[model samples]
Target: DAMVIQNPRYQVTQFGKPVTLSCSQTLNHNVMYWYQQKSSQAPKLLFHYYDKDFNNEADTPDNFQSRRPNTSFCFLDIRSPGLGDAAMYLCATSRGGTGLTSSYEQYFGPGTRLTVT
Candidate 1:
């Protein structure tokens, strides 16, 4: 079965400090997405990647960065996180699969809850 994994289910970081979150997938997908959610608000897409090409939301902060080492791994780097940056970080993988039925579907990993202290 396809799977996406996120390390360190919970993360704590000091204000104005840098932190990195990791995500990996065995689904061999060509696309990955990183989202941030706070409170009851909907998840916001911070970054998107299609074969190493990055597309970011216009409102995404400069402090947020992402890296994809290969087809199976992606990383989210938070530079100088502030109190408002505390939220749930979600990762997902999708596309480039054989079947058209689930082609537009995304497989998500358990989110990493980030706490800013």
Candidate 2:
């Protein structure tokens, strides 16, 4: 099955500690994205990588960062996690081009639930 995989489905970290969440995919999609979701709120797009180009949302906090070392793998690093940062971190991959006329479909991972205490 070609899909996204996230490690440590649940993570617990103390306030101000650094934590890293990972995502990998077998789909070989050209676009990979990271999103932060809290409860009923809509998932917020943190950043995405289209091949070697990195795009970050303007409103994304500096505390949230991502790295795509390769096509199959990506990492989200929280420099200093706060209690408010506890939420589900999702990694997604999309095929085709992202454009108004393109038919791009995004597939998401189960997500990593982070707990900051």
* Clashing residue pair totals per candidate (backbone < 3 A): 0, 0
What is the lDDT of every predicted structure here? 0.91, 0.93
Q: lDDT by residue for model 2 over 72-111, one digit each (tens)?
A: 9999999999989999999999875756755478999999
Write the residue-wise lDDT of candidate 1 on 17-75 in tens digits: 89999999998888999999899999889998998899899999999999998999999
Residue 14 shift from truth in candidate 1, angstroms: 0.4
Worst 10 residues of 1 by lDDT: 95-104
Alpha-carbon RMSD, each predicted model? 2.0, 1.8
Name the best candidate (by TM-score). Answer: 2
- Candidate of highest lDDT: 2
- Candidate 1 residue pairs in clash (backbone atoms < 3 Å): none
